[model samples]
Target: MSADESSQATALITGGGTGIGAATARRLAADGFHVVIAGRRRERLDATATAINVDFPGAASVIVMDVTSDASVREAVAGISRCDVLVNNAGGALGVSRVEDGDLAEWQRMYDANVLGTVRVTQVVLPLLRRSPRATIVNISSVAGESVYEGGGGYTAAKHGTSVISETLRLELNGEHVRVVDVRPGLVHTEEFSLTRLHGDQAAADKVYEGVDRPLVASDVAECVGFVVGLPQHVNIDTLVVKPVAQAAVHKLYRAPIDWKTEA
Candidate 1:
C-alpha cells in the first residue's frame, strides 16, 4: 500500500455521541480522519455521525457500544479493521458523597464506568492500533485524578486508577511504536455528566455552574485532542492538564467576593 493509503488514519472514539466525545469526532473528521464514533446511545451516535458526515463528507460512522460491557466492547472492536487513534473518553462521576456517607453501589458504578470501561475498550482496540505504523491512545483523565476534593472520594479514586493505567500502558507500549496520551481536564460543563452525578436533578446540575463565568467546554478539550493527534509521528504528548482560567485547582476557584453591592 502507498504511504497515503497506509497512513490514512482512522480514529475510534468512545462516548463519541455527546460532550467531549462528539466534539472530538467532529474535530478529527474535519482534520481529515475517517472517524468512528461509539457510545451507548444509538440515536445520539447516529446523530453525531450524520452531523459529521454532513459537515466533513465521508468521514464519520457510528457504532452502538457500552464501554462498561466486555462483550459490547469486544464486538465493536472486532468489527473495526484498523484504528490509528483510540480516545477513551467515556467516564463520569456518579454522585458527590463523602466517603462515610457514600453508597457502595454508586462507588461500584463509578469504578465500572471509569476504570473497567477504559480497560475493556483499550484491550480490544490495542491490536488494531498495533497494526498501524503510527498509533495513538488518548485517555480522558481528570484533574481529580491528581487530587482529592470534598464529596469526591469515590469518583476521584476511579480517575486516579485511570491515570495510573494510562501511564502503565505508555511504558508497556514503549517498544511497539504506539503513542499514549493522557488529557486531564478540570471543570468541564457537560449536561450528561452533571445530570448523571445528580441523578437527574436538574437544579443540582445547574448549581454546578451558577457562579462560573466560563468553564471548559467540550470543544475546548476536543481541540486539545486534535492538537495532540495531529502532532508528528515522533512526537508524543504523554499528559496534558487543561482547565478554565477561573479554576486554580480541584478545590480552588475564583469566586466573586461577598459584597452587599454585588448583583445577585
Candidate 2:
C-alpha cells in the first residue's frame, strides 16, 4: 500500500505497551497506519506512543485500557472514530502448573484475560470495523492451543479458546468484507509473558532460553502480523503458524549439538 493509502487506515492494538504488541504497533506505524496502542500500564503506553511519535511522527496514539473490563474496552473503542484494523494481543499465561495442583485463581485469570478479554475488545470494535472500507481483525494465538504441553493446562486452554473464536468469526464475517485471521506463534522471548508464567521469577524466565541456539523474538511475530494485514483487501490469510528455526513443532525442537560448533 502507498503512503496515501496507509495514512487513510487506522489500527488499534491491545497490550501495546510491550513485547509483540509494541512490535506490531511499530510495524504498523511504519506501514503508514494511524496506530493506537492500548494497554493497562499508563506509563508504558505513553512511552510506546512517544517513541512512535518521535520516530514515525503523527502515526500513533496511546489509550489506557484493560481488555478484561467491559467498560474499559467500550470506552477505548468509543474514543476512536473508525477502526480499520483490530489486533487482539493483550493476553498471556498466568502461571505454569499441572491441572490437579493448579491454582484456580490463576486459571480464572487466564480465562478472563485470554478468552473474555478478546471477546470484550472484539465486541466493542466490530461496529467500527464494519464501517471501514477494508477491515481486518487479527487475533494472536499460540502453538499451545493446537498441542498441549506439560504445565500448560490453563494457558493452553485459554489460547484454544482464542483460536476457536477466530475461526468462528471468520465464518460469521464471510461476506461482511471484514477478514479475521489468527496468528499462532511458537516459543517467543518476552519479559512480561515469561515473568507472568513463572510468577515473577526472573531466573525462570532466563532459563527458558538457556541452551537454545535462538528462539523466536517478538518482532518476528509482529512481522507475520504485518504481512497478513498488508495483503490485498480481497486476499485473506485464514491462519498462520510461525516458529523459530530451532523449533520444529510444539513437542519437538532441534537444539544445537554441544560439540558441533566447536568442531566446525
Candidate 3:
C-alpha cells in the first residue's frame, strides 16, 4: 500500500484475531478503511487479515500484539503511522468465582487485560488518531460493567474500569479531534470468551448460554461499532447497550428447553 492509499483512512483494532475484533476488522475494511488487526495469536490474525483482504484487497494487515504487555504494545504500535479509528477490543474475563473465593492472581490478570490493556493501547494510538481529519475511538465494554451478578465480581469490576476510561477520555478530549464511543454488549457468545472464562471447562462454558435460542454474535457487535464510527464526526454515540432479546438484563435470561433431536 502506498502513502496516498493509506491516507484514505486507517483503523487499528486490538484483539483482532477472533470474535468481535475480527468481525470489526472486516466491517471496517468493507467500509473502505485500511484495517490493522492486532493480537497475540499470529496465525489467527493472519487468517483474519487474509479474509478481509480477499474482499477488500490491500485494506487489511496484521500486527501480533499482546495488549497486556506494555513493551509488546508499544513495539507493535510503533510501526503504525496513522489511525482514523481505534477499537479497544482486546479484553476477556479470567474466572468465575465470587469475590471471597476469587484467586488473587486471576483477579489481577482480569484487571490487567480488561482495564489497563485498554489504557495502554489507547494511549499509544491517540496521537495517530489526532492526526486524522475525523477520528473515533470505540471501546468494547460489557454489560457486566453496567451491572453485576453472582460470581461476576472480578470481571464486573474490570469492565467498570473500562467504562470509566471511555467516560473520562471523552471528557478529557472534549474539544479534541477524536470521538469516544462506548459499546456495552450483553450475552455475547463469542467462540472463546466463555471457555476462557471457565478455565477451559467446556461443560461450564456451555451452561453459560444453554437453552438460550441465540446470543449476540461477534458480527452483531461489529455492526454496531461500524455504524458508530461511520457516522458524521459531529455525531457521537457516547454509550450504546446491546443485548439479545432473551436477556433483559444481566440476571434476567429467558431460557428454552434444548431439543436433543435438533442437536443430533
The top-ranked prediction according to TM-score is 3
Cα lDDT, model 3, residue 180: 98
Sliding window of 10 residues with minimal summed lDDT for model 3: 255-264
Least accurate 10 contiguous residues by lDDT in model 2? 255-264
Error of 1 at 158 (Å): 0.7
Question: How large an RMSD does model 2 have?
Answer: 3.4
Q: Write the per-residue lDDT of candidate 3 for residues 1-264, one digit (tens) a residue.
A: 468656779899999999999999999999999999999999999999999988888899888899899999999989888889999999999887888999989889989988999999999998888888779999999998899988999999999999999999999999887899999999988899999999899999999989897889999999999999989999999999999888889988989853445643
Q: Write the per-residue lDDT of candidate 2 for residues 204-224, one digit (tens) a residue.
A: 998877767778889999999
TM-score of each: 0.93, 0.93, 0.95
Candidate 2: deviation at residue 123, Å? Answer: 0.8
For candidate 3, the per-residue lDDT at 126 reads: 89
lDDT of 1 by residue, 1-264 (tens): 234433567999998999999999999988988888999999999999899988887688877889889899988877777799999999888989899999999999889988999999999998888888769999999998899999999999999989999999989878778899999999999868899899999999988877876788999999999999999978999999999887888888865533335667
TM-score ranking of the models: 3, 2, 1
> Under the 3 Å rule for N, CA and C atoms, how many clashes does model 1 have?
0
Candidates 2 and 3, the one with greater TM-score = 3
Cα lDDT for residue 224, candidate 1? 99
Model 2 lDDT at residue 208: 79
What local lDDT does model 1 show for residue 44?
95
By lDDT: ranked, best first: 3, 2, 1
* Overall lDDT per candidate, in order of appearance: 0.89, 0.89, 0.92
